[model samples]
Target: MMRASLPLRRGMPTSVLGSVSANLARPSSVLAAPSASKFTSLQSNKAPSNLSKRFYSSKTPNEIASEAQADFDPHAITAMDKQSPPEPGADFNVVIVGAGNINFGSDEGPWNHSFRLEHKLGPRLKVVGLIDPSADRAEKVLDVKRKSFVLSAYKDTIVYPTFADYVRNRDPAKPPHAFWVGSPPAFRGREESGRDLEKALVEAFPNAGIFIEKPVSTGPVDEAFAIAERLKSAGNIVSVGYMLRYLKVVQKMKQILEENNLKVMATNARYIMAYEHTAKLDWWDKSQTCGPIVEQATHFCDLSRYFGGEVDLDSVLAHSLEHFEPAGHLRRVPVPEETIAPEQRIPRITCATWKYTSGAVGSLTHAVALHGYNYSTELDIIADGHSLRLVDPYNAPVLYFRRPGDDHEEVVRYQSDDPFFSEVSNLIDNIELGPGSAPILSSYEDAVKTYALTWQIRNRSEEQVRKLGKGPANF
Candidate 1:
């Protein structure tokens, strides 16, 4: 089994503020002064009372709004207009940014997992450039032919050896047509690195379609909105890496919901990976990498909303725990003796509840305390007359329909192929098709929604911890 640990690499200073570091000074006036009247009713009625008892017993509405505006601007929305659909088979050059494990050949990485998909895409979609802070790593992963363009170091593209100059000097006729950002979450005490890479991409390649990894924002929500806004203003295609959206099982689940004319009542998702699989990296700690909510549960939140078919998030309550006493004969991994102080450690367990605008409810539970390589995601959708269930990350998702007269279950399987290809292909098509067409499977807007929900859960959970005068284990 692959262990999840932060690798210690000696090179860049940890504190260097990259181009995309959180810049809280430039506030969005719109988010700062949202229409309070429009949200008064919802705020008063749906706000979690437990949160008030624990964290905000004496806070005023204005104070809460101010704090929220600092993290996220409810009013910010992408302004990119959908363009006219392109002819089928139109070719485009793509520049892949961030040679992290997800995008490139890391030890047992997903990038290599998607190789068959890349082969399927063929010559039309060429990998024009590869970007990563580590030149050697990038070179090893992106070993292009002699005639192919392979820029090793990130700074090499400009005057300081940056991507800017490379793009400028490249044939304007073939400027990178698209951009794929497969970097990890800006956790691992490398928040600035993630931000810098994003800023560089935005400034250097404004015209390319941009795809970012999941949990789009690792720190302040406002920073994420700002980045999204910049991309929107630049007329860039920003698609987040919520791979489940493209999964055959999930697609079939969507079809099931539409076919039954059902409305979601409640949803639940659980993710369990071995602690060893996660604790390998330094950034795996909660304060840096984000709790399971932002790091992993974000996927569940997004998929729930996707299946629920709603946009407005009403409220959230969350709790977490970092240590567990082994029970029975269960063995426990010994905590590292050289581990950082307790506060910086990631939680082993997390639970959160979401009340959506559509009157449906959602809950998520995830833990790294499990003993084996186990990953299970189940969504329970309850409607007026029946309930539907979806299970598994891959195809052959089992579906159970419970109706008044009869109870039956059916398994829907997708043809044997790479789910990533399906999603990437759809993204390319969406980029070419422009906006207003059958909306892209997942959009930047969806990314923002998932990110916001994850942020609220983590923030709210932290508030609970602070109010209780205890650490993460209390939850």
Candidate 2:
């Protein structure tokens, strides 16, 4: 829960302003030769030798920069549409709202945002502000990521204890070009938590791009839509982080469907998380995390909607394997004593089916049953005589498909694809290059539907439990 923010006022207390360190007036040097043979002031203590350890990176940022490009005309279409370029040294500036796994990648984190930005953009990405209510927690996460990432970009970054603090004391001259919101779903839609900050960001930095991670909100559909309306009015460039939508393999899937003029008939999605890891965490508590479907499986749910189009909310139906379900080959996940009994916990697995407004149908199966630090996520689309399957989207995503009258399944592999980078890059490009860049696929308004679907799946699944008179003990 968020504490009440200080009302907007004139005089700034030195304590709230202590976090601002970057001298916006004194622009740094292209983040000082970010990924070169020579070291820069912003370079990390590490010498950049552990490339093998990273699971998704195919090449170091320097190797990809390819400094050998020929000079282009300033009159080119890309340069023409580009927004007023930043100062000589600053390429992009953003304020990140959270300091959790998404901001700092874990071995088992859903995605990498800050770590990748520092690694790829180096000193060129100026993080002007870092906000979290728990300043100590935010500092800890920053410390860990700083040690691991290639650049120490946030060494002098501003730290705000709350959104209100950032609002009150932020330098009016150096307003960020974009806002990177990685806060939890619970803080996303509620006015006191999400919308208030969102509205403030809009008023404070009109037309600034916002990159929001999913599920965009944990509230009802109407609540999210209300926030979306405000954003639309401000003309803020909004991109919700459904990163899978940017995958080259997913793009190929879309390309083939368009090439063959195919309409999806049915879709299948499965997201089975490694149970040994997640069960011991707060995720096992249904009330806190809003169940696994909304918190975790929502990626697949959004993907299902991506290909299947608008969902018929009335047609959503779901079932689940209860925590108290009988055990045989499957051992029940141990329940935390604090949560009190297995019956009150979220289900071990959930299966749901729903229809698209386009008449196509979709199904999803999510289980918290795999072992160790492993997870399984895959989605398949079936059109008339064509089939499209995407596997292991997080790393080395592969697409397998068969068009009309094909013998065996053909494959398109994008082992080096970084949808995480693509998603964030697109947000920056959309702001800079406008229509010259590919537009964001998942806008704030569109993401509200995905949030609503996850809630619908969770609600209907729990309703099934209630029908059997197997309600939680608290009831």
In order, candidate lDDTs are: 0.49, 0.61
Candidate number of the best lDDT? 2
For model 2, how does the per-residue alpha-carbon lDDT over 37-140 read when each residue is reduced to its tens digit?
21111111211123211211333221121121111111222211232333345656778876655565544333557755654455578777888665666787
lDDT of the structure predicted as candidate 2: 0.61
Backbone N/Cα/C clashes per model: 23, 0
Clashes of 1: 23
What tens-digit string does per-residue lDDT give for candidate 1 at 1-475?
A: 1232111111121221121111111010010111224222211222223322222234322232223222221122211122222233645666665444455444532333124224434445556555444555556455532224323222223111234434555556657766665544442111244344556666677666676656664445544555555555677766666766655556555555556666778888776655544323333444334455665666677777776644344467877664432321224544461364455555666788877666778888877666544455567777777776776553244556566577676555444434444446556655666642323455554565577677677666666666777763423
RMSD of candidates 1 onward, in order? 11.2, 14.7
The regions of model 2 sitting more than 4 angstroms off are: 1-91, 119-122, 141-152, 193-195, 327-338, 341-343, 473-475
What candidate 1 gets wrong by more than 4 Å, as runs, is 1-91, 106-117, 144-162, 165-173, 187-206, 309-314, 324-331, 334-338, 394-396, 433-439, 472-475
* Model 2 Cα shift for residue 115 (angstroms): 3.1
RMSD of 2: 14.7
